[model samples]
Target: MQFTTRPTLSGTFGMVSSTHWLASQSAMAVLEDGGNAYDAAVAGAFVLHVVEPHLNGPAGEVPILLAPADGEVRVLCGQGVAPAGATVAHYKGLGLDLVPGTGPLAAAVPGAFDAWLLLLRDHGTKSLADVLKYAIGYAEHGHAPVERVGETVETVRELFETEWTSSAEIYLPDGHPPRPGELLRNPALAATWQRLLAETAGAGDREAEIDAAREVWRSGFIAEALVRQAGRPTLDTSGERHTGTLTAADLAGWSAHYEAPATYDWNGWTLCKAGPWSQGPVLLQQLALLPPELPAQGSADYVHLLVEGCKLAMADREAWYGDADGADRVPLDDLLSPEYNAQRRRLVGDKASFELRPGAPGGRTPRLSAHALVAAVEGEGLDALG
Candidate 1:
């Protein structure tokens, strides 16, 4: 018998799981209302944007993996690409070595909007109105704010008040963060979605309506708002106000597409993950380096080995993995090969290793990013000063 802390759940019909109860309930409601898994996922994701605003939002990216009952498992590449103007030269000219962690400069094309619609267009069996109703209701009407939402608001309260007044208007009600369980609403976000739905009117069928909504998001009012904001100067983590280089063309140029998932067979199971552009491939590489027979879960030996395997894989991720569009990209085929992993696995030893060791895949030398090299040089300088 397998022992576990949580009760083993079993079900036959359908199930939905999410970080927030509201999101799960919204998905389950869709499932109960005869929507398929894809429909339920889209509904759930939108609710997460509303309820877990501290964590996820419409501007964020999504990498989706789905297996249709009649089809093979595939990955939907929802991760947005950087704007054309977001070049190394642009940032270098701006006197910045790294992109600010906050502000419009850090944003990619808002892929979550089109990606969710794309999934619904291709795989889902519901109308756009049907999927968005739950999120719209939550955003327009008040919903109890999560504890973390309040905490996140408090953390950024000073910044909101001083730098981002638009955010302050939405998050800070009555000039303060809402206490836990207090009802919070975002009428602006609700209006955005409502306008999207309104724009889809007169589109032929459900598929056409979804496509129309996609266009509205990319080139219509949504794009207008984003480009307007991008052109404005905003305070960032760099402690300087910088206007974004992203344009309306940048938002219009990008769209989410599907691609084959990278897979690794372990024991009797095949695991699928998004490709090199994401941190997902690191998980596959870690599995390849780890022993086939792992020690029991939660054991000290298991933890040690897992940590050791991860260090080697993470180092390679820092050095090799990047956007697949360019000529220079991840050597994924060679990295995942049995021969390559066998050679790399030998480096994981009993002791914890602090050195960053990126592997030479296909005998090609690994090149660390300029940012990584700079960080290393800075660390050495600090050490010398100490």
Candidate 2:
């Protein structure tokens, strides 16, 4: 459950794994040279693409939560949007559901690279070279493979295998993945990194850097591979996504919004997290239902409540949650408040609470900020009788 990273390189840092470690190192190097946290963060993320390919790549999305030293937290949404005319109806019309690799469909505008460079110019004390030094070194000389990374490579080898004849020269040779400790390296990636590392902006237009990074991404053989899956000949986009409008145009025309996340107070703790645009508020809503003193950490009652709460949360999320930007105004705040949670918890039977829920209650509102601890009034905890 402890999914976090802390690097010796600088200020209170965290990453998911070792590639994230390299990214952190690159950023920390910037921070050590007097750069701010944002500078370090950007440097780290940009490098993760090459180091963590199956997950992150230039075509991949980037979303972040940042709290500056003296400012309120802000979100930068780098998740790419489908093209100007992309409709879910169209997807259904085509019946194309198979997802390709770190590819065109998953592509959003390559904003992180540009955003990172911009962050550096505004907050970093070091030069761009200083920020990218570690990334360049790793791309060329290679670094230690992170745990499960090689396993992931092996798992997905068949999906990306091409019949282009020279394609084996590009990826796996003889249809097998590179083994662990075999030095995962990419010279194409190195050349791309060198371009960004060496470029000098005329007026510090960081968007240009994002453009360059995305351009670098377009050169890769995988970038344009959607053609292989195209079922229709004239529609331009086959079943696979082509390197289409997820471009510098999209990046240049884009603007990210900063929104406040939701929080809940439960069991004498204030739980802070994202909104119902994801499953974040769902967890909060479930917790808000139980009495303030539901066991301490992991008693029997605690385990039962946690499992039951998770089930309730999942049901609600499925029924209500969707994109905050595009869908009906979701009742995320009201959903997470104590009133609705309390009402929903009623669905759980006092004796067992292990069975059926027809549906959630309606028109509830948060009423109590502080409540008396109502843990166990009569019997021993965790008994079916109680």
Candidate 3:
């Protein structure tokens, strides 16, 4: 939550809840105890695991970008990536358009806890035990389920909740989400956290804790627990004979990468982001393409223009966006460049709408298709057909 190139006397904290406030307070406790932003973030994320498991958890990906006072911005990609054996064609063969959530096979290499530990080792002021105490306490003792969460689960019908009994049993108990005031507990997750603590104890003070936690997280327990919770054995790992090459080792091999994010200057704000995976620049493309001033009335026309621009951008994203290290980095900037937007904007008009024929590569529209000839003599259209 803290962002700055140079250390100042103060900073701001952002949150949207009674619970986030509690987590922030814990983080602020770390800060007040002389911990750095890295330490605060680590503490906060762990707290979120217990308090905000719906949105995030040890079982989920959590990519982060940290900019400290060092003048260099560091990005930690906490988002999990598909296992080495996984590929686009692999899922297609599994009769899937997209891998479903928190599933065993869809489980990416979880690197958040490790990354947090690492950041602390190098920059943290508090010890590993100190940062984790709050979270561990919450996990072991338990807390009441937040009100809004149960509503969301019911609203979604947990429709995509995956039919496995282990998963269903835990979530759909009695065919319903836990009522808002219900006592929420996760002793298994707590046990895992404790093991991480023990493993990290012997390692070098704080940083090594991160490395140790990584190993614990990557252990077979991850797959086992997921299987137990999901209430089923692992799904077929061998995707079509050729597509799914993922062995369990592939899961262990995947890790989050670190890199610098891209930045742009727009509307006086210093727009910052990372490429390929990040969704920022695509939004800027739609914004820049619009006329500098707003339309007289926010009518269907204005909405239509935005959607059309989004369609073009989304098509480009699906076709090209991917892991930069593992795949080709598309010429993403080209799509949002001022020159490109200007040309595309020129195609728009204030009058009646026009249909645009999208074409193949090189951004060119294909010529209209030829039609069968049905020649007719002057004033003899019907006779000619006969």
Candidate 4:
């Protein structure tokens, strides 16, 4: 078996691993300071916003799964909903068939801030000030910038300069991307957090303090800034610049909530994942359809089987998955049933199938998105196996 270059370290206290080393350190600091897992996660997440802005930002959304030491596993629905003005009709009015991958039109209600705060307030043992200290410090005093951050900034330098001037002001210092290992400061974001912190001064208790911070984030300068900037056109991948529809009212109206996880039992291990609204259930369904016994890891057969299984699962996802509360929601119960999986398992063959096969549940017809249909048409004859 192949071994990792760095061996796993055993610890009785705790362990925190993130995409960035500084984020891991920030979480570890929380743990060392006697904070619980939720507190540590919140701290790490905020640090990630400052240090890995290229990957994720404060305005981005995140789907979190939290498993407490004694409590049941829960899903924190941090994936923000579309703003009130964001509708199929609205995008079509803009002459857009698809939402542009970047810029204003692509923005959703910023959920990460509220979600993290909710987790901290409800489950954490520490105060908001304590959890946020590391993030604020890093953003204010500066941290060593990663190579990828610099590379992404450099790649988008022209776009920033020409259209996204606000972005250029933050990313390009002295008209150039900051070099890797250089100290990078985001005083604006740091000040934003600090202002939120300042709002907690006269609160009654820890919970109240957190609540005050959430209110500030939703209705204060952050919301005002988003509302102002979203009204202006920005460049996007669709080769067109567009303005956003998100409003301050949208931010004020939204809050993160917890929900039960979708679970499936396989070989005495129960796997839990977010609902069909996410791609999580597709993974569970794929695992359910796999053979009880499998070939050796890293073997060609093993890789081929995994890939084929993924394709089959993804086809169903494209056809059936949508908002859980919607009329056309996936029938997850029937999809995961033993009888249904047994029937589906029979379709897996020695050779991979190029066809898209989506199972029908209780005679309900699958709903495929327009994007999927276009891809299916354009992807013909491009199949690697052919």
Order of the predicted models by TM-score, top scorer first: 1, 4, 3, 2
| Clash pairs detected, candidate 3 | 63-78, 85-246, 121-207, 166-229, 166-231, 167-229, 167-230
lDDT of 3: 0.59
Stretches of model 2 off by over 4 angstroms after superposition:
1-20, 96-127, 163-175, 197-200, 205-252, 266-271, 349-386
Query: lDDT tens string, model 4, 1-386?
Result: 68788987898889998999999999999999999889999999999999999999778887889998888999987878888899999999989999998888888888888889999999998999898899999999999899889899988888989997866877898898877778899888888888888877778699999998888878987788988889998779999888899998899999888999989999899999988878898888888788888888899889887887787678778877776355145788887777777777777788877766666655667666777766765655123212
Tell me how many clashing residue pairs each candidate has. Answer: 0, 3, 7, 0
As a whole number from 0 to 100, the lDDT of residue 97 in candidate 4 is: 94
Q: Write the per-residue lDDT of candidate 2 for residues 226-258, one digit (tens) a residue.
A: 223222122223434343334334544544344
Candidate 2 weakest ten by summed lDDT: 366-375
lDDT of each: 0.86, 0.54, 0.59, 0.84
Give the Cα error of residue 152 in candidate 4, in Å: 1.2
Q: Quote model 2's TM-score.
A: 0.69
Q: Can you list the residue pairs that collide in candidate 4? A: none
Ranking by lDDT: 1, 4, 3, 2
Please list the residue runs of candidate 1 whose C-alpha ends up more than 4 Å from where it truly belongs after superposition: 1-5, 374-386
Two-way lDDT contest, 1 vs 3, winner: 1
Worst 10 residues of 3 by lDDT: 367-376
